[model samples]
Target: MTDEVSISRRRLLATSGSVLAAGAFGGCLGGAPSEGGRSGLPSKVEVTMTSRPTPKFEPRLTHVAVGGTVVWTLESGDHDSTAYHPDTYGPNRIPPDAEPWASETMSAVGETFEWTFDTPGVYDYVDTQAVCTAHEQIGNVGRIVVGNPELDPDAQPALRPPQSELPRIARTRLEELNEQTHSLLSDEATTSTEEP
Candidate 1:
């Protein structure tokens, strides 16, 4: 029995040490964004949907590498992440070759929907429930930038027809998202080019 206890204690200590080490170096992990380069892009990101204090998608904008995946986790209230595509009764705001997606209503807390983005481009999405339309009217929309697709920043999908047909607040938010994506990717390009 003493030998058994000793072995169990040794195992516990080893596990604790490993946990502490991992915690100490957690920031060095791959998922955290790095400075000025495509290498900074994450392979996966989580977006949260909340209803209290007004319905909204936390982060509002996400940046991921090509083939990266985004998981929409419903933290509170009913929500679904739906892309802005003709099939969804909206303009094509995602990459021309990208497949459109729409998550079913997730009403339970902690429920989630995920999609892997294969094409490189800017994509716009929203929680498309009628009750949430009011939330959208106030700019509760989301956008994702998958990799860096060459796009005329000024002519981004948000500024085009049908997509441009979104509510003024939603349009404004998307335009801001587009500008941010352009700035971030452009800065990365400039830095990479300037490096030796």
Candidate 2:
């Protein structure tokens, strides 16, 4: 019994320590998730949950190197970090062998969830809370593109699920979200060129 208790305590401490380290390092790095030392990892990137002018992720689309991580920080509204998988209803966008992850739908500001991309693939995720009529199924979705240095981000970002297969609201929202991403990318390209 004592040994079991000690093991549990040790696990808890280790988990807690990592969480704290992630929080501190992520905060310092402007909200990106912290990763254990690894090669080929592009620095972590962040997707923020915003409630002010709109309830949505700050960067709905993210691109990272194959071994990178994406951090989702909940600022408001009930939300969770959920990967697209058969369990979540699909047209799955993740790699066939990628493990799915989800966070409990909670509204606590500063709550964060992180996932590391090991395989080069497109990963679509969503906030799994039913705050809106189609909250978890629609506008709450985001995309992560884990690209190989040798190739583009792969089929991840473009592997959107069949819109016609979803409920009307979800389909409409998804289309709108895609358009927003398109516009955002276009804007970013223009901005980048202007920078020089």
Maximum-TM-score candidate: 1
**Highest lDDT scorer:** 1
Candidate 1: residue 61 lDDT (0-100) = 74
Lowest summed lDDT over 10 consecutive residues: which window, candidate 1? Answer: 27-36
lDDT of 1 by residue, 1-196 (tens): 6999999999999989965763443222223443223555778878889988878887777777888888899998888898888887467787677789988989999999999988877888987766645666777788887776666644346434336578898888887876766676686578569668
Steric overlap count per candidate: 0, 1
Q: What lDDT does each candidate get? A: 0.74, 0.62
Task: Please identify model 1 stretches exceeding 4 Å from their true place.
Answer: 1-38, 153-164
What does candidate 1 score on TM? 0.75
Tell me the TM-score of model 2. 0.60
- Write out the backbone clash pairs for model 1: none
